[model samples]
Target chain A: MLKSINVPRHDRVPSLIPDTQASMTRQEIANNNWEEALTFVALQRDRSAYAELFSYFAPRLKAFGMKMFGNEQQALEMVQDTMLNVWKKAALFDASRGCASTWIFTIARNVRFDMLRKKQSRKDDVSADDLWLNGEYPEQEADTDASQWDTQLLMEKLAPHFASLPPAQREVMERVYLQEKSHQEVSDELAIPLGTVKSRIRLALDRLREALDGARN
Target chain B: MAHAIKFHPGMSLLEQHAEGSLSADVALAVAAHIDLCPHCQQLSRDITADLACQLTQQPVKTNTTDWQHMLNDIMAQPQLSKQAAATQAQLSAQAAEPIIVNQREFVVPRALQRLAANHGKWLHLGGIATAKLPAGNDYHVSLLYISKDTEVPQHTHLGLEMTLVLAGKIVDENGEYKAGDLLINSPDDTHTPRTMADEDCLCLSVLSAPLKFKKGLTRLLNPLQQFFY
Candidate 1:
């Protein structure tokens, strides 16, 4: 169940890659154009496009699941379930609402939640209504290019922003967001007040907002 | 943006909704609110993307055998025809229309439409009316209607009570709750909810347990609290 990848802990050593190498890698990924790949799967059921998406996202999703669940087998299951949903619900992808990454990420998040709930023996009776609301989709048409560009730019900035977060804020944010733990749970784990836990999360989010807005401007 | 709801669900609730940790009933209420609130919608999107970006950076151990099996499963599934797709879209669009009770019409939030068909019989209680909605797991849900200028007896919840105002205004000690406002009250809260004189108020209330009436005369209704449940 655990196929260990022998990669170095590059997240801890952010400067291992030279600036030029990092930028080139970012450029290459941006050039792959996730939206077009999703469109291919949606319209043509293209195997190669699906394969491309699977190769890119499945591994990352597994990593994300492991971080959240701390179990390799469950993480693999999460990756499998998320990819299955992507294949089954490809046509539901709406570029007008968001980019491919945003859509897929939302799916992965929801899938993880479902798995957690099922593990706790909770009933799953939420109708489709609990998923999306309102007839008016967020109209990104006016600034589609700008927003898409911002999304890509933000993705590139994520690591640096995370690395720069204050230690307390970073720990809370990681526990709350990445590990899928509630603020109350984090407070208990860290032996801090719940209010402190919330404040730390808020401060981290504010820093990210400021940094991302700076990038946009 | 004039007359926008002053009170919204906490950011943590929205975050939970985005993360999928919220119960289905609470999530449905939040989804309905998100449809009505742009600020929340944007926040939810931002959080989702941010989480995704962080996850994308993690180095993953790829299991080739599992990947091959998944690919095979995906390939074997049948695809929907264009006609079927169009029809499904049409049906969902039609489902978005407003729900009518007597002469009053309220635009059902897109997320609540699927549950619209299961709305129970409307039971009149003094100036207010309620109809139980389908139970989702542990919670009992109901659509509550308060006539203009009507006041509900002071009450506190037996367990957690989440009320999402769907239309008009409900005033309590906390604040004026208008459409799209979600008020979460635990056992510690006690308040008398009165509607403004201008228009009738509609709200969806999800309760973890039955509400306990705390005031005079209404306390007699406590024995009949099972009725509300």
Candidate 2:
């Protein structure tokens, strides 16, 4: 059945993935069994292995989607699509090119933004160069202490910080990001005005973004 | 000058963005933030210098042989048909030149512009024109030059659309996006885009799917999308 038709398992089959039970952090996951895991996913129609892969990246992918779509629900959808591709394209994962996290993150990132590009229909704007630039490259690198482990450690260290935030601010963030609510949705959920939700989320995001950045330094 | 939202892009993101290693979505958001804050731009450059120095420390893995070979495999493998290649070429083209906020020519990396320009003659899609590149996939690379006060009609989308502002500013319900801003719209999101009058705006956009027109006679032209894409 595998070779009767010359179709690569990568294409034409989007399988149902079970939940991943891997106990390792992203780095551990990267160092151990990542390549083998990819090989397994690539060759056989394995559901359990794909699930473990999805479990690790899904939350982070959702977080990224939240940032991009500005809402949690949409972010969830984005992560879903990203993980789906990851499950199917596990065969394409190459450790030499980049770490599994970087590869998966790149895919998730592209998928999230791809949706954004679709949202803004490509028509009728005379000079688009104004609002969007094709060439917005940053020459800057993640110049943290190279002697230390990957920056992922820093982000993990910052995870507990969510508990330290002002309850009000954290609530706003949770509603908007964790819960995937819109500004309006968050407000309604909390019985607060829309502006309050917007201000709280904005202030919370600013603080979090700054604090996280500072921690890396 | 019109109450531009001053965005304070943090140091870490600036570092990652300048590194060109951040995920593209984060990069786009960070780009939007950078567009609003010149302070971030200066800092990003400083960080860029720091990153270049730090790069000296990143040694090739001991076991790794030629890194280029792995990259060659990805590059050598074919993606989608004409749709994917053309699309990637268009993206690579826009990425070639970093969109200078106020420059006439697209300020991209030399490598990218060479690729996009390598594609056949561009198809002018009234307002912003497009060219179906020789690359794979349903890639539609286009340019938009909006004279002051022009409003691009409201429209929906099918697949994915990526826009890179090459000049001026365009405002949708989302917010006023200035030069060097990347405004991405998720699928099914619709908005009326208006370009302020006085200054002509230039932009480059990549549309993955055919657009779904919501109003007016423009819908009639939907079937004949080759010219418009």
Candidate 3:
């Protein structure tokens, strides 16, 4: 009989084993040293550190891209562009504001939106083309210390919060929050009244806020 | 402010903005509003962080070949020089200076500042003056300046119309819209916008289609709608 190894939910301690050690799986290494690895790439231009980040995030980004764009080629391009941005903008990442996952996810999200907008512009002659012309604004100062936002702890809390939502509410939450679909689009897709979609999203957000606030307190 | 902005673009619109799904014009309007409103900014940050968390929880599948390719592309890209970055920042900073309209100098919203040079000659129509902004590709973009106590003719939108109050206040059947308030109107909605007697109203109006005049002598302005564009 095999005993399951239980990982601690909010451990900040670094694993004693080196990330490159043969005994450690790729996922284990990534989970253990992502922040350190990202910092190394940022400060030292370490190729190996970048390789670690690329290996872990590129695939995840590709999957996210595919989900957003529904095209394998575009998804691959999105991953490539996003990874390139990470490499270039690594120095700008402030741990105090957000975690590396949040930073990278934002880059992927923005890149996907850019691709979609470009496609839309080519197909239509709409007048609002100059709207997103400016690059992203500077990052705002963090309201609190980074330690207050333990990435692993938040992630652990979030999964259960999301899982606890009713299926109807969760569907709207996922579509709007994760899939980035508009309320009108989601309403049309589900063939439900717009008010129903809005209420479900509101309820889902309220529950998420309650759970996250509870954790904070 | 007589009335607080009773109307907002809804959470879904803000969420789309945070998710980077809104169109550039709408996004610009939203970004300008976010710059002035801290409440919306906090909401935006929360939504972004939540989305990031959701992304992390999803199962990821990718081949080794994809990772290798991504690494290659990242390696091939040249790193931006610190000096170059500093110069770029300086350029943007210089470009953000306020523009003078009539005698009043109003700081352009960062989103609109980039297109400041493209503003056309100020054209006066009754008590309302308009300047066409060359930036919007899909919508008719203009800066409408309404003098104190002036009233715009009652009109309905032929399509979607978005008005973002950049300065002062405008009142309609809905409510009073102050600086940073975004008022969106569709074909079904019709209203006459009037400026308060205390101050002149300045607004950035983006129209997907022309406005249809609904009352009185203004109905004749329908054929002259091209002038508004």
Candidate 4:
């Protein structure tokens, strides 16, 4: 029924990491500022530190891509591009609002969303705020939005800018967009336990809401 | 900000910007999203910061692109006339072209680069290359390349080995894994693996020790030294 290798030890995250929960735990994340991390890494050119972050993130991004597109090539490409962007824009990581993982995922989410939009023949510039708020509504219903007086101002009011988001959270957003797929499909595609996907999506959405409200007020 | 909500695309735009991979216009769209949704906006900033931190660590030595070689290649291009261009277009019309391998980044992502930098050199087998990495004193990290149509001998093992199919597909006791399939092996498991006839198999694997042969002739070669590469 299944192929098996010898009884060697194995792990989910590479054995290199100590205290894996430091990333999982929100308090730990609070202590670990992504902006500060990026700045420190940038100043030192510390390869090991970079490798640690990559080890933690790349596989998840790969997993996300695989689930989103169901194509290995595209998945690898997505992770590659995501990492490359991280390299080019390390100077931009800000620790004040969120953690590192959330930021990276948003990037993956945005990339896949664009792929879907190209096929959908939609106009440019969808905001995260709109996606969260407006995505719940059927397309035609949101058409006559009351705040349509000044389209530009409405857009500004509706959309908030994001630089990067972690892979897990991004996967949640991508599930609904490009795949034109359901949340369950997203879980199946990523091979993650379905509940994990739901939780992450809610978590990501909550963070997005907070960010928007903060930006507004 | 159009007729449809188009929620996830906004997310995708964020991903593109975070990765620094989006075309200019697509980026503008996500920027607008961030302008409205701070939740994603904040998340985007954090992840971007993390990625940036990781990038800052990459040694700058390689940042010096091989421009000279690139320019030389460009200069060395065989300039074909406009007539050749027409001929090329005609050839494309006649036959289906092959898919291209797209690897734009010079260094593989940090997550994957560890597969190389931290692990051992690639060991080349018959068209199929294999490498064993030192995960620990007992554990091993392996990279396997099974060439098209090649049949691996049925073998059992004393330890557990887990394989994550990275590229291509191979069939054995288990089902087919195109990519992103995590196949875990326990002790006493055995099987003969054959690569999909068309493409070679590339697998990133973790193993504990040398495999113990269960079936036949492939066991004989265990003692004799094979190609180092």
Best by lDDT: 1
Candidate 1 off by > 4 Å: A1-27, A30-32, A65-78, A88-96, A110-124, A133-136, A140-217, B62-65, B78-93
Q: lDDT per prediction?
A: 0.68, 0.50, 0.67, 0.47
Chain B, candidate 4: TM-score:
0.48
* Tens digits of per-residue lDDT for model 3, A175-197: 87667799999877765445456
lDDT of 4 by residue, B47-154 (tens): 454444333223322112322232222222232233553353233123222221221112221223322333455565565566653322334555566778887667
Candidate 4 C-alpha error for residue B60, in Å: 40
Error of 2 at A208 (Å): 1.2
TM-score of each: 0.71, 0.37, 0.72, 0.32
Worst ten in a row by lDDT for model 1 chain A: A1-10
DockQ of candidate 3 relative to the true structure: 0.15
DockQ of each two-chain model: 0.17, 0.03, 0.15, 0.02
- Candidate 3 vs candidate 4, DockQ winner: 3
Chain B TM-score, all predictions listed: 0.89, 0.53, 0.87, 0.48
| Stretches of model 2 off by over 4 angstroms after superposition | A1-207, A210-217, B1-112, B132-139
Error of 3 at A77 (Å): 2.2
Cα lDDT tens digits, model 4, A1-217, are 1112111223211233324455455223333444455555444533345445554556667666766689867766666666554544444455443445555665566556555455445442232222221111121222122224353542354234222335656656556443457777875666443444544544455445445554211
At residue B17, candidate 4 shows an lDDT of: 64
Chain A TM-score per candidate?
0.51, 0.46, 0.50, 0.42
lDDT leaderboard ranking: 1, 3, 2, 4
**Model 3 scores what on Cα lDDT?**
0.67
Tens digits of per-residue lDDT for model 1 on A1-217? 1112212232322211223334454434433467777888878776677766776777788777877889888888888877877876677776555557667777777677667656656433554425653123564323232224343444566647888886767888778666779878886777554445654554466568656654211
